[model samples]
Target chain A: SAVISQKPSRDICQRGTSLTIQCQVDSQVTMMFWYRQQPGQSLTLIATANQGSEATYESGFVIDKFPISRPNLTFSTLTVSNMSPEDSSIYLCSVYSPRQGGYTFGSGTRLTVV
Target chain B: AQSVTQLDSQVPVFEEAPVELRCNYSSSVSVYLFWYVQYPNQGLQLLLKYLSGSTLVESINGFEAEFNKSQTSFHLRKPSVHISDTAEYFCAVDQAGTALIFGKGTTLSVSS
Candidate 1:
């Protein structure tokens, strides 16, 4: 199983500010997924980041709002731009590991917009 | 496309009692089913998964889920749940080469 280190487990930001959450995997992976879980809601896929390519955003998610960066196979970052109260949620990164036979998730970054 | 449905939003049970969390999914193609547990302020952990061969998959923590292809269901069960078993359980499904689609999740509260 690959270990993931997510930075700034929790953060608080102004409504107009932005926050970037980083996820580092112990091993390289082809794709990384970003998900958002709003208060009392289910996890929703934000986008799929592939190394050296533009991210593929889900239906409701836009690149302007939730920008994703996959510089390499082992690392990715998700940025929440122009945060709002509604944007406050738990952001998680995941990677599918063939050796683990499952998806490995980051600890998650809890964001609060004030 | 794929989607998962977890029948219950919450399940309250006494310690050492049997419990079941129902899950169903709809997908046009063959899919893999999985059960994930998320403890308070923690990341999601894979409980068990049914990829192929066996219809029934068991986790190391005394939890098992049976995949019923005809019914399109994969319900998780524990014969005797401990207090530590209390957590939010999510049912997810994915096709051969896609991201997982998760359910709303079931919050299991076990008390003594």
Candidate 2:
């Protein structure tokens, strides 16, 4: 299984600010996905990070609001732009390893926008 | 696309007691079922999965689930649980070559 190191674990930010979450995979992955889990809610897909190309965002997500960068096979970053209190949630990056038969998720970034 | 349903939002059980967490999913295509456990302040860990072959799958930590195609259910069960088993359990489904769709999750509270 591929290990994903995601930071900063958690952060408290003021409204109208931006935060970027990074996930570095120990090995190359077939696919990388970014998800947001609202308080007391299930995980929702934000976007799929594609290497060397623009990320594919989900229906409710937009490039301006949630921009994703996939610089290489093992690295990806997701930025929440112009965040508000509603944007507060746990952001997680997940990677699918073919050999593992499942996805490996990062520890997640708990962002609290006040 | 697939959608998962976890009937119980929370389950309280005594330590060393048997427990079951019900999960049901709907998908038009062939789908894979998986159970994941998330501890407090941590990421999800794959507990078990039903990719193919036998309908029964077991995790290393004594948790097992049966994939029932007719019922569209993959309920997790443990004959005996410990306090360490307390956590949020999520049931997810993925169509072949697609992203996973997760259920709302069930919080299991194992008390002494």
Candidate 3:
């Protein structure tokens, strides 16, 4: 199973500030997805990061507000641009690990904006 | 495109009791089903998945679910659950090699 490590497992930030979350996969994955789980809500797809290309974001999410970068197949980063209280949520990155028989998710970045 | 529907927002049960979480989906093409568990303040872990084989799948941790094609449902069940089994469970569906669409999730509470 591929192990995914997300840096800054949790953070508290002020509104208008930006936080960058990084996901590192032990093995190269063809597809990597970024999701945001609002408090007590289901996980929502934020974007799909493709190696060496611009990310494809889902509807209701914008490239300007949630910029993504996939420098390589094994690593990606998502940055919350100009955060707000409404952006407080858990951000996670997952990669398909055949050995895991499912997707392997990062520990998640718990963000709190005040 | 695929979408998942989890009928229950929450379920309460006692230790050593049976529990079932219902899930349904709508998709035009054949899709894969999966169950994921998230403990408190944690990331989701794969519980089990039904890709192409048998409709019934079991997790290493004693959880099981059956995929019903006719009903478009994949309900999770546990005969006798432990306290550790309580968590937020999500049902999702995806194409053979595509991304997944997750349900809202059901919060299972196992009491003493």
Candidate 4:
């Protein structure tokens, strides 16, 4: 099992600003994923970050808008850029565990853009 | 590609009553099934998963799910629920250790 510590639990930001949410895992992991959960909606994958490679984003998401950084096996960050009210959501980081056949997730960073 | 459908958006049940959260999936190949629970203001926690072998999988907290391959369904059930069981539950699928494809989620509201 991996424990992830995410910083800035909740933040209120102005529109057009950017906020970087960091996720630090206790163990080394091959892949880290970022997700968004809007109010009254299910989680949607934003991107997948692998150490030492460019992040792979899902449909309707782009690196320019939600850039990701995976500096090493145990750490990753997701930046929400050019924020808007529509972008206000809970951003989460998850790491897949093959042995467990599941993913361990961070507590999530709640963002409110005004 | 894979997709999961959690038929019920919300389920309200009285405490100590049986509850079932239905989940169905669509996939062209073999897949793994998982159930996750999310409490208020927290990240999702794994409830249980079906990888291989027996079709029935049980979680520590008395939650169980039956994997019916023919129907492509993995519905979560608890014989009796508690007030603490009130939370959003998600059903997900993955093929060969890939990223999980999640359902829309079912909100289980266990009340008195």
Score candidate 3 by TM-score against the native. 0.96
Looking at the true structure's interface, with contacts defined as alpha carbon pairs within 8 Å between chains A and B, what fraction does model 1 recover? 0.52
lDDT of 4 by residue, A1-114 (tens): 888999989999999999999999999999998999998788898988999999999999999999999999999999999999999999999998887767888998999999
Is model 1 an incorrect, acceptable, medium or high docking prediction? medium
Candidate number with the higher DockQ (1 or 3): 1
Question: lDDT rank, highest first?
Answer: 4, 1, 2, 3
User: Which residue window of length 10 is worst by lDDT in model 3 chain A?
Assistant: A95-104
- Tens-digit lDDT track for model 3 on B36-81? 9999977788889998788899999888999999999999999998
lDDT of 1 by residue, A7-46 (tens): 8899999999999999999999998999999887778999
lDDT of 1 by residue, B1-112 (tens): 7899999999999999999999999997888889999898777889999888889999999999999999999999999999999999999997864798899999999999
TM-score of every candidate's chain A: 0.97, 0.97, 0.95, 0.98
Candidate 4 lDDT by residue in tens digits, B21-102: 9999999999999999999877788999999999999999999999999999999999999999999999999886668888
- TM-scores vs. true structure, each candidate: 0.97, 0.95, 0.96, 0.97
Q: Give the C-alpha miss distance for residue A93 in model 2, angstroms.
A: 0.2
B1-112: candidate 2 lDDT, tens digit per residue:
5789999999999999999999999988788889999888777889999999999999999999999999999999999999999999999998764677899999999999
Q: List the residue pairs that clash in candidate 1.
A: none
Give lDDT: candidate 2, residue A54. Answer: 91
iRMS (Å) per candidate: 1.2, 1.2, 1.5, 1.1
> For every candidate, what share of the true interface contacts is present?
0.52, 0.41, 0.48, 0.52
Model 3, A8-107: lDDT tens digits are: 8999999999999999998889889999999999999898888987888899999999999898889999999899999999999988766555777899
- Top candidate on lDDT is 4
Clashing pairs in 3: none
